[model samples]
Target: MGRTSDAKEKILSAAQSLIELRGYSALGVAEICKAAGVPKGSFYYFFESKEALALAVIDEHWAGQKQDWTGILNSDAQPLDRLRQLFEVTEAGQRAGQQSCGTVSGCLFGNLTLEMSNQTEAIRTRLQEIFDAQVEMVDSVITEALARDEVAVTDTREAARSVVAQLEGQVLFAKLYNNTHRLSPLWANCLALLGARVPQEALAGS
Candidate 1:
């Protein structure tokens, strides 16, 4: 049972990497199985279909994201500083060649929201819930910062949404341009939007 679980995790990780490099439409079950070193029989045993596997991949991605974000939020550092570190993790991922986020790989949820929302209500609803949860997490962090007087945002919810939007936009831009340069301005904008003590000149230059 443990070995079977490990195989399933390996397949999900491979699928995630492949989907990030090539959008979902370009990936195939055979490729995922090959990358994972699992047979097609095992793949079928674990996932009923490619769509099911995709959903699993999404769940795995969000699980990892939640863990990382929770750690950031619970850290002893100042809230705003913790947020900056979040961006730093993003930049580090890009630098480390994880150039795209699984959730934003062609903006998975966004793409599905447009293409499959009508056909696959379950997937669409799940995707929406995941994104909403992400936004709520950010809002909770920002709200705490406001309560502590560590930041001065006019609206914590809107500020959190803006941060999410900026990050999503950066991912889209990076994917479109095939370069991380498009993300530089977004980091600056996020800091400004959060009312962080970013230098005016630096923000302007970014």
Candidate 2:
């Protein structure tokens, strides 16, 4: 049982890497099996189909992101500091040329929504739920920041949504251009919107 579980995990990991690196539509189950060192028959033992594997990958990705974001938001640091840390984390990943992670992988949910939402109600609903949960997380963080007086904002929910939207836009632009450079202006704009001054050293091109 343990060996079987390990093999299943290996296959899932390989599938995720391929999806992130090459986009979902471009990934093939055979290639994933090869990368995972698993036989084609073994994949069926774990997942019913490639589509099921994709859904599982999406769930795993969301779970990991939720944990990371929750940890950052719940830290003892000031609210603004927490938010800044989140951005810095992403920026560091960008600097490292990590274009394959979920957020910067051009939003798996959004991609699925665009491509398969109309054809598959299950996929569409699942993606919507994921997005809704993300928004709620953002709202929680913003509300906490407001409570702590770490950031001054008139509307926490709106502010949270705005931040999420800006980040999404940055991801889209980064993916479209195949470079993180396009995100700089959006980051600066976000700082301006928040009425906060970005550290000069952290400014793009600085």
Candidate 3:
């Protein structure tokens, strides 16, 4: 039983790394099993299909990311400061990935959205739900900022969507250029989207 569970985890870990590095369309079950160092039958035993495995990978990755995002965005810091820390954390994460793998992996959901979302209804729907949740998280922060008169936005929801969009777009640019510097503009762009009322010097320290 322990070995069976280990085989399942191996498949998931390998599938995630391969998908992150090369994407979903190009991989095959045989290759995934080989990478996982498991028998091909183990892949079928754990996942009914390649798409099922992909969904599992996405869910696993989101579980980790959601925790990180929630911790940062929901922290005790000031609202705008929380947003700035979110961007800083994002940039730092990308930089760390580049250092470890010699390239930025960008956001997994964002990558899969561009690569496979349009190709499969299941993937498209799942990606939409994930993104909507992200927007909701940001909306909460913006709502708090608005209450405190820290931002000028009248439509907090829309502003939050724009901020999330900007974050994804900048991450895409970082992956495209293979340079993490592209992410440096995310905080400034987010402030512009929110029309933040905080003084520049005040935010600079964050």
Per-candidate TM equals 0.81, 0.78, 0.94
Model 2: per-residue lDDT, tens digit, 11-55? 988987787677667778889999999888889998998889988
Off by over 4 Å in 3: 200-206
Give the winner by lDDT: 1 or 2: 1
Cα lDDT computed for each candidate against the true fold: 0.75, 0.73, 0.90
**Where does candidate 1 have its weakest 10-residue lDDT segment?**
98-107
**Per-residue lDDT of 5-102 in model 1, one digit per residue for the tens?**
88899899999788666657678899999999988889989999988987898788778877987898778887777777887776566655633443
Using TM-score as the measure, which candidate wins?
3
Q: Model 1, which residues run further than 4 Å from truth?
A: 1-3, 98-119, 196-199, 202-206
Q: Residue 124: error of model 3 in Å?
A: 0.9
- Name the weakest run of 10 consecutive residues (lDDT summed) in model 2: 95-104
Arranged by TM-score with the best first, the candidates are 3, 1, 2
Residue 62, candidate 3: how far off, in angstroms? 0.4
Q: Whose lDDT is greatest here?
A: 3
Model 3, span 44-101: residue lDDT tens: 9989999999999999998998999999989999988898899899999999989988
- For model 2, state the Cα shift of residue 156 in Å: 2.8
